[model samples]
Target: MDTRRPTIADVAKRAGVSKGLVSFVFNDKPGVAAPTRVRILAAAEELGWQPDPVARSLSTQRAAALGLVVRRDPTVLAADPFFPAFMAGVETALTERRQVLVLSLVPDAAAETATYRSLAAHRRVDGVLLTDLRHDDDRFPLLAELGLPAVCVGRPDVAGAFPVVNLDDAAGLRSAVDHLVGLGHRRIAYVGGDVGMLHGRRRRKSFLEALARHGLDPVGVVDTDFSAAAGARAVVELLAGAVLPTALVFASDPMAVAGLAVLQRQGVQVPRDCSVTGFDGMDLGRHLHPALTTVEADPLAWGRAAATVLLRLLDDGRADDLELPSAALVLRSSTAPPPDPPG
Candidate 1:
């Protein structure tokens, strides 16, 4: 009945095994017999000798903290439903192992690099999660130089020996374009995100490929930042042309909502006059008037997957580059064939 925070020795004594055997079992090391392993586990559980993660890390030369670096406004991240949902998934994965998540927001590449270096120097975090990657991103090379266990959420042009978790952006966009084309849309306008981001680049490339496949050159291609206001402005610019497109593919749900409002204000009948398709299946998209046709990406699942992979890298000293599932096209009332032209 000794109850002073039972140690590995206590577990070994209770199981009638050596301390080394207990260590091997607790550290997930191979070579212990099956029957003996079960007995050791049961003894540890009975004595409440659950391995102290912090102490184990100290002995094993590993850090227990996981750093998540997001290059965006913290306020925007807090308010955005997508990030919150994704965080939920990440938390769920971490909770199972009782690990802490340290999130950081950096405005620029220099600040981001500084933060990573500080974290690494202090050995405060074993691994890091990098989001919002751009073409020729500085973080890619810097992370490689630091030799830190890291996972990038987006694909960066710089190739290195680090794990990456990339979304199937091209497939998602292809599905969106195919849906609109199937709806008899010929002159489709594209409202995309900043060309600097990899996801935006992939979306635009898919859009152009879809247009070529249909033997129809896109009527317009406007790039804007990921904001509702930007989406509205892009739509207006497209409409200013001599021939208005019959349908529009917006790169984000926020932009799609803005575009929808603009069309309504201009007395354009959605589906009847112009069809709209949006990426990111936001909750608001489902509630929009003539509900938005959108590509549904599961942010929660993506976040959980990212966290799980990062955790592995932290705990096992192994890097895993994984490609997550792509978004699915969710058809709704926002899209329809172009209205018949008067003879």
Candidate 2:
């Protein structure tokens, strides 16, 4: 009645390899022949033997995890619809490789920087996924100094020091703006997130440029923190302003949803008085009456792509930048020509 757990020595014996060689295979150390490594792993699998996670990390100097440090207000992060699908996709990819995600929801820049340093210095993760790239990003050199591999989720202004998973943010905003212009909305307004972030800057620039192409200027531009309260506040000001816009283009679905409510509450007839459009194409948009018109860019796909790239980089020490699909406008009942075409 021997019911002992299988050991690495058993795996080595079954594969006709030395104990040290078996250790090398599990640690994913270099200098092991590819075919022999495969055979050793197969033997371990057959015996249902696996090295302890702590022991493996100590030996391999890898945590078998990836880091994602988000710097935002907790309340704002909780309401952001982009994460649900994006995180689902990231987890899907990491799970395949027996890896996990280490998310840090930090409140400020100092905490964000400290978190990255600690994660890198302690070897707590194989690498990190950089999001919310800022104007004149400081993370690039910091990551380089720490020798921590990273994948930027957006293109930074400067040359990338690591792989990039660039999204077509401009395309989405342009589509929203173009739709407004097509609908005879000369006085179109833009509601954007913080201009310091690349996505916010890109969308705002695109909105202005799109209108410039049509010989029109934005009736208004409100920069908020992509919060429901901020969105509601922006809408109130726009509605109360001296010159009301015929259409509103919100940079995020949450903001759009909030604005939609505000407009309806104030007795503003959507499409009859002022049409509305949003970005990110979230489900909440569709649930609202006169479903929100938005740009169809898949955040889930973006997350999946980013995770795939980071995993590849961690494996081989290098990965190439990838450009995801461009966004297109999803027309809905929320958008239409102005009630009275401006002469």
Which residue pairs in candidate 1 have backbone atoms (N, alpha carbon, C) closer than 3 angstroms, thus clashing?
A: none
Expressed as tens digits, the lDDT of each residue in 184-265 for candidate 1 is 8888899998788788888899889978888888999999877888899999999999779999998888889999989989
* Per-residue alpha-carbon lDDT of candidate 2 for residues 210-299, written as tens digits (9 for 90 to 100): 889889988889999877788889999898888898899998888888898899899988978899998888877877788889987788
The most accurate candidate by TM-score is 2
Each model's TM-score?
0.83, 0.85
The parts of candidate 2 lying over 4 Å away from their true place are 1-56, 341-343
The CA lDDT of each predicted structure is 0.83, 0.87
Error of 2 at 341 (Å): 4.4
Model 1 C-alpha lDDT versus the unseen true structure: 0.83
Off by over 4 Å in 1: 1-55, 74-81
Q: After superposition, how far is residue 29 of candidate 2 from its true place, in Å?
A: 7.5
Instruction: Point to the candidate with the largest lDDT.
Output: 2
Candidate 2 lands at a TM-score of 0.85
Error of 1 at 32 (Å): 6.7
